[model samples]
Target: MPRFAANLSMMFTEVPFMERFAAAAQAGFQAVEFLFPYDYPPATIREQLDKYGLTLALFNTSPGEVNAGEWGRSVLPGREQEAREDIDLALEYALALGCEQVHVMAGVVPQDADPEACRATFISNLRYAAERFAPHGKRVLVEALSPGVKPGYLFASQYQALAIVDEVDRANVFLQLDTFHAQKVDGNLSHLIREYAGRYVHVQVASLPDRNEPDDGEINYPWLFQLFDAVGYRGWIGCEYHPRTTTAAGLGWLAAWR
Candidate 1:
């Protein structure tokens, strides 16, 4: 069976962030992931992980100026310095928390931005991040955000993300496939799983259209879980979804997997 990680960012919103660690452990999750951990000290987050005996699966670098509509600086030209700073900060947190993977966000493209320039900037920034994290035994991840949810984002297709990984050409850099985004952009998910089985380093899941629990989605998650096992995908599958009702109430989908 595939190991599932509770995404604290989208799951368990009934309690505060810190308390969600215990909630996840109580719910029988062995690992957890979140969007960003810059709001709290790394040591504090580590304490909760140790207390609950949970492994920190993954997290992303800070999205620069979220309110200003900036998802990241890596894909924005002339922001190489800021991107490096973001990478360094994320490395600090990953080492402190004992995490093995970090997602490097590709910022949204400006209305007047050149697509080629943005792609080049993204490749360069990813190469830099990979080099930096390689020495510490860490991996760098790049994800494709759906254009509908994040309009003008760098890329929305898994092919685009895979191409970026190829261009970066670094062993440490890999794709982070989110099923929700993949289903939104490209619907043949089964083909994607089989075709890119060993290419991606992490996987995230949620229902299509509603972005709810995986149990009722158009995607057959139970079969996908079996496929993941067959393909030798030994990585954490993040539960990055909003519940139909309460988080705890909607977790019946996880019981069979547990």
Candidate 2:
């Protein structure tokens, strides 16, 4: 069976943020992930993980001013310093929490922004993050966001994310293949797994359109899970989805899978 990580940010919202760790463990999850860990002290998060014996799968670099509609800032031109700072901060937290990977979120691009400039900035910042994380036995990951859902997001396709990872030219920098975004932008899910599994170090999933639990999505996750095993990807597949009902109630799909 594939190893799965519960996304605390999206999966266990029924409880308080700090309390989700135990909930995930009680749900029989051996690993967990979330969007950002900056809200609480690193030691506090670590306590939850130690208490539950759950591995930290992945979390994103700090997204600047999320309330201002900023999904990420790394890809925005002139924000390289801020992006680098975000990397350092994430590294600090990751070290303290024993997490081995961090996702570099590509912030939304303005309509008038130059695509080339954004790409260059993202590539440069990614290289910086990868270099900084490599010494600690950690990795930097980049993901392709679905275009319509997060308008103006820099990486809207797997190809784009792959190209950026290639350009970054760091062995520790890997693509975060978010299946929900892949289903939205690239439909050949099996072929994608076969061809690009080597490029990914982490994976996330949610049903398309609604971003719900994996069972009812257009993409058949069981087949994808088998394909992932066939392709030799032994990494954690994160359950990053919004619950249709209470978080615990919505976990029937995962329970059935288990």
Q: Note the clash tally of each candidate.
A: 0, 1
Best by TM-score: 1
lDDT of each: 0.94, 0.90
Which segments of candidate 1 are over 4 A away from where they belong? none
Q: TM-score of predicted model 1?
A: 0.99
How many clashes (backbone atoms < 3 Å, residues ≥3 apart in a chain or on different chains) does model 1 have?
A: 0
Q: What TM-score fits each model?
A: 0.99, 0.97
Itemize residue pairs with steric clashes in candidate 1.
none
Model 2 TM-score relative to the real fold: 0.97
Q: What is the C-alpha RMSD of each candidate to the true structure, in Å?
A: 0.7, 1.2
In terms of lDDT, the best-performing candidate is: 1
Candidate 1 global lDDT: 0.94
